[model samples]
Target: MELKPIKTRKIYEEIVERIREFITSGELQPGDRLPSERDMAERLQVSRASVREAFSALEMLGLLEIRTGEGTYIRQVNIESVMSSLTWVLYMEKDAVLELLEVRKILEVQVAALAAQRANPEDLQNIEEALKQMYQDLQKVRLGEHADERFHFAIAQATHNKILIHLMSALSDTMERTLKVSRSKLYEGKDMPERLYKEHALIYEAIRQQEPSEASERMFAHLAGVEASYLV
Candidate 1:
């Protein structure tokens, strides 16, 4: 039988893994300061650049907070953010990207329904504000990716389920990247941005009117359109 070659990791990735182990083993705690880059480099027997690279990645994952004058400290762990960052790296293949969209369709359709039935005034206001932002971006011929993400996140918040909110947070970064790619493809059709905005408007209207089924349907349709654009 033929064997596949072992994959080699970058030095910075190995450093990241080591720091993750430290956190997992309780050697690092929230608010605990990390060693200086020089110290870490000497301890790890690697260059300072690798340690700095690892620290930057950790900061992006919300696992570390780097203050300008105060140095780097462990941030209160946002497990969801960490998971999402890992997931983003692992699922960059075409089939994996489609799988991510499938997961989104499953979770978001139900999330829209729940938001329709349970949304408070504040939740509605947030969703409307995101929708307004989308329109503003469209008027300026921009992608409005942030507003699109905020719109869906606001709907998830409206569900009032802590677990669902956490799950959405975990998926947020990956979804944002997917949307940016899909929107670029869709915008090639000129009217596609307007079409997308109208679809979001319909979903919001259904939720605002407390129509769970309609909200779910609209959300499903919107996601299907995105998937189609991505495939194109």
Candidate 2:
């Protein structure tokens, strides 16, 4: 996790990765101010533009809090900030949010499938409780969505795979804000809770049945509907 200087063929990207590693490894902690832009360029032995672009990328991820005339500091970690910025990735002017959704489909469908096969009795109980909370909060659609998000997050934690959890966490953070925004715009303001409750119930049942494939399908199907309803 040491922030080595960029050495790869794609120099700029390597620089970006190294900078990320610095924060990841605690070489730079939250609220820890970074050396000046010029200092970073000189220390990393890269052009100033490279440091600027890398810092910009990190700032967008909420890794670095930049203040005019004050300097840049490591910001506290938050996931949705990362994902929201990732949503803007465009290739040749074509929207890649759909591709991002597909990636989420792959990761989360597998997460649900794993939760079905591997989730402990306690995990099942927790998920059910979360579902119940969601059901009760249906009258408060925003509350329901919050509970719903927690229910799925519980499933991810149940897997007990630290690396997988970290990876999914990053991905989840990226879409979380958008998800909330879209939910408010499309569902919370209307009759969206019923459908959401139904969808969560379907997934919950499949997990309770310990049917990994069924659980995965339910999750994927739910996400597909969500994408069509919101991100698309």
Index of the highest-lDDT prediction: 1
Go through the candidates in order and give each one's C-alpha lDDT: 0.83, 0.74
After superposition on all C-alphas, the RMSD of every candidate to the true structure, in Å, is 5.9, 7.7
What lDDT would candidate 2 get against the real structure? Answer: 0.74
Highest-scoring model, TM-score: 1
Tens-place lDDT digits, model 1, residues 166-226: 7787677666655566656676576888898899999999999999999999999999988
User: Could you give me the TM-score of model 1 versus the true structure?
Assistant: 0.68
Please, what's the RMSD in Å of model 1? 5.9
Q: Could you tell me the lDDT of residue 201 within candidate 1?
A: 99
Error of 2 at 90 (Å): 12
Off by over 4 Å in 1: 1-9, 25-45, 59-96, 132-146, 166-170, 177-181
Q: Model 2 Cα RMSD, Å?
A: 7.7
Model 2: colliding residue pairs: 79-173, 80-173, 83-174
